[model samples]
Target: MSDVLVAVETVSRAKQLKAATGALHEALDARMMGADLFSSRDRYALFLAMQRRLHAGIAPLYGEPALAALVPDLPGRAKLVEIDRDFADIGATPPADEPVFVDPKDVPAALGWLYVAEGSSLGAAFLLKAAEALGLSVEHGARHLAAHPEGRGLHWRRFTQALDAVELTEAEEARAEAAAVVAFRRVSRIAEETLAGA
Candidate 1:
């Protein structure tokens, strides 16, 4: 029998999204590296401040019914609560204002934002380890970086499965890609602005 999948793009949505934003992601990673983000308590606080901005910016997206339909656990995926607690643990308050990028109801663009937000949890595992050196942990100043109760790999797989199953229109696909780029650029910009203020 002939294979039934020949027409489908073998590339997964997760991979396509990664490819779309890889360069921007790497540039931000390099900038974070050079920022000495974990070098000391002050630097770590600045890093957390930067994180506060990014996570707060997208915190609203997790609640959109359309987006939640895509990723069932989307509400539980929010890091703002943990980030807020981390700020408290560090004796700092996250600044009240954060720039909003996309409307939460814009499901396509929101997915792009979610791509960056959710994917960062994997990297957070490493950041959590680094936070340990600064006397931070899941219970302390690094709560946002703690692993999911379901485990990181499995959690990521669930998100990817949901992402991959989405069948977006050509126009929607373009929107998603543009939004992903915007999300990365926002992170880069926020990193610069946060560190500059530091």
Candidate 2:
């Protein structure tokens, strides 16, 4: 929590916009529901609430008199457009032809997968972009797998090894590269059946 404030600036409107945008992206990216875990109505209700607050906070900053004048217009708008597109992608209906439920026990896993696919694509993109804008070199990525909280965790050693391989080949250290790779992988895996058929 304390660390989150390090990048937050109260005075500068630009920083506030960036921070607000980042927070919104992070929330949208979180795994909130699965197929059988929650009703679509419940999930949509939560999403609408989140969308309202994000719009409320950023509206003044973007639409106000003084602050909007100060900040460069195009970049901020571009970022906003990016977020909007991501949200649309997330809200898009899943394929009607596919089975809605598989193993009951795997419902949580399926929901998590959807979140990672929908949320991670845009969340990772926004964070990586923000990190780049601030010139932060720290790389960040996430993986969702079948695991229990009290049971075994992901194989960190093996995961690190794969990341290391990527890092070694990359000429410049970039947080965005790692994030994009993770996002691409997630989306690709989810859409593989359709992709293969095509």
* Candidate achieving the largest lDDT: 1
lDDT of each: 0.89, 0.30
What pairs collide in candidate 2? Answer: 34-111
TM-score per model over all chains: 0.94, 0.23
| Alpha carbon RMSD to native, model 1 | 2.4
Q: Which pairs of residues collide in model 1?
A: none
Quote the positional error of residue 139 for candidate 2 in Å. 35
lDDT for model 1: 0.89
**Tens-digit per-residue lDDT, 1-198, candidate 1:** 987866765888789889999999999998998988888878998988888899889988988888889899999999999999999998986777686778998888999999998889977887888899999999999999999998999999999899888889989988998999999999999888888877
